[model samples]
Target: MNEPEEGAAPDEAATRDASAPGGLSRRGLLGLAIGGSVAGLAVGAGAGLAGGVALGRARAAEDAHSAYGFFGEHQAGITTPVQDHLHFASFDMMPRTDREDLISLLQDWSYAASRMAQGLEVSATGAVGGSAEAPPDDTGEALGLPASGLTLTFGFGPGLFENEEGDRYGIAAQRPAGLERLPAFLGDDLDPQASHGDLCIQACADDPQVAVHAIRNLSRIAFGRARLRWSQLGFGKTSRTTTTQATPRNLFGFKDGTANILADDAAALRDHVWVSTQDEPAWLAGGSYLVARKIAMLIETWDRVRLSEQDAIIGRDKGEGAPLSGGDEFTAPDFQGTAIDENSHMSLAHPEHNDGIRILRRGYNYVDGNNDLGRLDAGLFFLSYQRDPAQFVSLQRRLSTDRMNEYIRHVGSGIWAVPAGVKPGSYIGADLFA
Candidate 1:
């Protein structure tokens, strides 16, 4: 984690008062200070100013309604109640960057992320208060908006420890044994441009604007130190981490994550989700491995298929989302049943077939506009967390014969070592350098 810099706010409490009545909220003031425009009010002079102040207070109030704590035992996005929107990004460290520069960048990023998660500006001075000649510290697009329960989770890719040129960061020796590139899968049509990165950030939120705003500001902070390799904007969460959340449907109109590991399942999380010190290079004790796959659904072809064929392919009832063998959404699949196809997605992906193994899935459906032929360029952006990446490898290899592969193409992929969460004064990844 990055050290708290000179201008960084020490804690969320030091940032701004969420209950204050009629002053410009920190975000509003920061936005106005930056280049954001205030609407011209029709009211008289004093009323106009009061109206502006009220607007700021209202914005703060909305933000306070759904804020997530930034500092915790583990990162928020992974186990935090699944958010409605996602902005996932991958970045490559600039050439010749060293350890100190990388540490400074992480520190700066942590500072900014902490403040933003609490609905505060990146810094106390913010955009307007700095030097006039210099560019504003914040981009200011999220000025009047609430934090929207935003969570920022960071990760280190394999390339971060040792690049093609060599171990440029010197910390390659500390790389966890589980941190390595994923092997090519059977039907992977992976795009190199979107495949790998030195670093990644998964920002999820209840509001789309808030999610995008967080990534935009973070990308700005990384300006010279790193450059964006690929980014994905996703909506309509395809999984439920908490039991309270109802299972969400993917773009295929089927309920996804029916058998996913719930956040409240402590035993499941410890056994399958979190990495232990015994399994790693000490710093990654409470960390997790993230496997991201940009799977593009062949919507046109899938739509043309008969409903029964589609149901057989997924091994679930389209309306009720139950296993073809019978019972409700949560019922275990009876793979032995003749009705359930042996090559179906449910049969192949079930824990019974993969050595009783399961990973925590937090995926989202994405539609990236149209393809050259005008069909929807969209599918499930699959994101899963596991204690060891080998678990995923094992499970995915078993899924090689899945019938659902016909309707999807693996277009982009990445795997990263998500470090354990930070303490009060520490920044993300701080343990690595320790």
Candidate 2:
């Protein structure tokens, strides 16, 4: 649910249907079915249209700070590919004041989100105010719990805020890593003086039903811990749309999810995340991470690329994110590997290509169907959370330039100032942004 420093994550490497035991385990279930299963995730199928209308007044008058929740590790276990019982869910939270009530409300939300993720539609609409009532048509359907193939996930947007920590968040931090492998961006620890942002939790379930519940439930926990406000948002598993394809199909059609970065576990952190090389935030010690990016793709321009040429430019198989230069999915490109046309693994095709630019990409793929223009439309809701977006932006300006630049375009963009973890009632970024 949470946007990565870059964008969306991949479905393949993502655990879609596996469950690990205890806190350190993978999400219960993960992965999304490519075929009919897509239909099963009727994301907008709910009375969302109706809920919008019904909850209008109540939502307008509801006490923004009166509701909240928080509960971590009450149950501990990591599940991956959470089956179809899973779906990505998140809240468009609004900052509020009252922390205690907000926490309790989140407790209810946690239970609600958790239960719903398991295929139990606790309420007609997961709305915050007057729309809380379950509609009549949703009776059987809303009440029905998803069985098999469910995966759930969630995210806390910038809107979420707490008292003690301000904007600072809480998450277990790991030490700095991969300095020797310095990405083209900073070459060294970029955030030599920054701290980890506040808490951000993620979960995946197999079944779409389960995914929704998992996200909502976890969201509740977040609310309980801090005085917060929220609203549900997001879609099912993300894939390419037609407008985004080489021929204008699927989100920017250049074969999606290929550039994603996957860190298998705590060990992979150093290689993927970033940390300060010198004395930094003592509390931030051992905590090294990146707020990749959120760069919107220009699908219309991206569709102009000829299919075969697309493959050659990225120097990897287009369908899968393998390097054309050589290597399997997730394998670091052999910068020295032979190129399709005597090119280097990380060399820029554009005249502006610069070896000095290197960025760790952890973005996701998205398809926001045809816009009002009726032009085939789609693009990445790209996000790459990095120690410094500057590094990524600099490198991307170069990468986005190569021959591939014509195919994709930078349409929407945003940057968030993230911080380190904090104790309950604590705010984030108190020392810095605050």
Candidate 3:
């Protein structure tokens, strides 16, 4: 498989009744009160605006069904329930962007994300009602929609800390030891355009419109500060992060992430996923490193393979997704017999053979239309969160000789240090800047 060109245009909400007992929506109240404060400028105007913002936030916090908390020890998207849709975008800082500009952008992004997470618009002025000459704060597509469990995760790439010439943002010294460029692996036809970025944003939600809207507004916010390097739209989550979620299928038509690290597995998360304060730069505490691989599945080739051969390659029954050596879906695979090949995908990726190392997978399936040769351009966009970059590096190294390599090609790759979650009053990566 050949690496395609870098540029690709990639591609949600609940409805709340405005006429309910409350009469006005929480966001509507906020807009009116805040807008009133600006117009009045009389006694207690400051108090009115503050009270309105606080009240709006309180209402948002109470929305556990549709909103994931923005302020937490770790970011939401990593451990949160895998949403049905995804809009992942990587960006490169503009040529003369300074450290302060980066900080400002992060602050603006964090504030906007917080509001959006609560089913509110990016700004108080919203998509309309702002000055006629100014662009709308929000894109307006997600208007009147519920938050849809929206999550916005941010990460900093190795290039963000330092460039080839030298430290660009003067924060190279603060870079986490685990944040490094991934080594070229076997059978990797990596595309330069989609490979690396200075930063990335992963926006996910149950509603496809919500996911796309989040990224679109965020991109608008990043206008001059940064430009999109690459983006991907994904549907059909391939992994289950929470026990409540059922395992989803990938492009290979097999159940994927049957043995993934669950969000409730606290011990597993601490050991393999979340970065600890003791790991290195304390700023990354509670954060995790993300490894993204654009694995292009040769659908035409795989579809032609015999059924038995496909089963042997994946080591799982296509119908039940149970291991050949297993009894049921959740049953542990018994690698003792001839049931599973030594180089099968399951055997190589299993934690037992990988020194008990497992990563939290939040992958998705993508179909980007037909390729140049008329073959379906589709595959699994593999995303994994790990405590250290080395965890993924070591794991991928073992899979280099796996039998499934022939059916898929690694075309795009990226590694980013996902900083700790934002505090209510702080921006993402604020500790690093401090």
Give all TM-scores, in the order shown: 0.87, 0.47, 0.86
- lDDT tens readout by residue for model 3, 257-284: 9999998899999999988878899889
Candidate 1 vs. true structure, TM-score = 0.87
lDDT of 1: 0.79
- When 2 and 3 are scored with lDDT, the better candidate is 3
Q: How many clashes show up per model?
A: 5, 165, 2
- For lDDT, the strongest prediction is 1
Worst 10 residues of 2 by lDDT: 21-30
Top TM-score hit: 1
Per-residue accuracy of model 2 over 1-434 as CA lDDT, tens digit each: 11111121111111121111111001100011111122222223222111222122221112211111111211111112211111222233334434343333332343333323323333323322222222221223222232222322222233243324353232212212221112333112223112122223333333344444455444433432332221222233232212222211225333433333233333333433333344243433323333322234555555677776666765657666566656675565555535553332235522225543333332344454677876554444343434434555555555543554444444432233323432222222222222
In Å, residue 343's CA in model 3 sits off its true spot by 0.6
If the candidates were sorted by their TM-score against the true structure, best first, what order would they fall in? 1, 3, 2
Q: Each candidate: RMSD to true structure?
A: 7.6, 14.6, 9.2
Candidate 2, residue 49: CA error in Å? 31
Which parts of model 1 have CA positions greater than 4 angstroms off?
A: 1-65, 131-133
**Cα lDDT, all candidates:** 0.79, 0.32, 0.78
